[model samples]
Target: MAFRAYGEVQQRTAGPKEIELSLFRQITEALEAVAAVETPPLEAWADALYRNQQLWTIVATDLVNPDNTLPEETKRNLVSLSQFVRQCSNRVLAGNDGIADLIDINKSIIAGLSGIPVSTVTEEAA
Candidate 1:
């Protein structure tokens, strides 16, 4: 989810509002991608690779852009990513984490959200 939110950000705007929106979208996408079921033979891995690459590109650019709407927010996201890069250490088939890092990214997103409170209790608690 974060990736999509980040992608929607339009740094070219007057106040970098567009870029902020993109960042928000990327955030949401990255967050949601976590729970999505991986259906083999359905190009799921490829899709994930494509999306992650896109997200990384935007994030990298934003990190260096002086016009970044929310510099602190961007940094926080990068820190989250950095943590994932370290925490996701493991073996892989073709230079990738295979499906392991997906879990890490999801966990990272949750960690990123740690400051936010979850106001509602779901059925599991009942």
Candidate 2:
């Protein structure tokens, strides 16, 4: 009975939205850590960027899955955004742009998932 209850708790904690939000938070923290250092070690930056890329890849894959319920247009938009993230991540790894935009993108997605208006959240963040 105790084990079953624990499993139920785990299921509740690992719902789709919770999982996505957690991933976003992790990416945000990793990006912030990289940004906090004037010259972050290549390994640390690479690890964080790779994780972010992996998360987006998974999101893209899920968006295209037949089981996914998102509208066709929404899936296309998300897939496009994921591709952009992949491109930007490569540039960031190559020392081109900063990670602020990537962080902002993840934050915006999280806000959308949480049912918060993006404009309001952006204003508050600013």
Candidate 3:
């Protein structure tokens, strides 16, 4: 009985959208941490950036599924954005750019997912 209760709790916590939003938040927080340090650990920054890329890859894959309920244009846009994320992540990792842009993108998506007005979300990092 205890195991079954735990399973139910896990299910509640791991709903697809919830999981995505959680990951986005995690990535955002990680990036913020890296940015705060004088000399951030490359491994930690790489790990967080890679996780964000992986999340977008999953989103792109799901968007391409026939059973996906989103409108065609929406799916297309999301897939395009995912591609951009992949490219941008590589550039950021290569020291060609900062992670601020990536953090902004994730925060925007999180605001959308949370059904909150983007304007109301504080622009503060993390």
**Per-model lDDT:** 0.48, 0.87, 0.83
- How far does residue 101 in candidate 1 sit from its true spot (Å)? 2.6
Residue-wise C-alpha lDDT for candidate 1, range 1-95, written one tens digit per residue: 98776545634343644444444445435434543555443354455444555555566666767776666876777856744544343233254
> Which candidate number has the best lDDT?
2
Clashes of each: 28, 0, 0
Predicted structure 2, TM vs. truth: 0.84
lDDT, residue 116, model 3: 90
Model 2 off-target regions past 4 Å?
1-12, 123-125
Candidates' TM-scores?
Answer: 0.43, 0.84, 0.84
Location of the lowest summed lDDT over 10 successive residues in candidate 3? 117-126
> Clash pairs of candidate 3?
none
lDDT of 3 by residue, 5-119 (tens): 9868976878888877877887888878887787888798888888888888999999999999999999998899888888888898788988777777787888999999776
**Cα lDDT, model 1, residue 13:** 40
Residue 78 CA displacement from its true place in model 1, Å = 0.9
lDDT, candidate 1, equals 0.48
Residue 51, candidate 1: Cα error in Å is: 0.8
Please give the TM-score that candidate 3 achieves against the real structure: 0.84
The residue ranges of model 3 lying beyond 4 angstroms of the native Cα positions read 1-8, 122-126
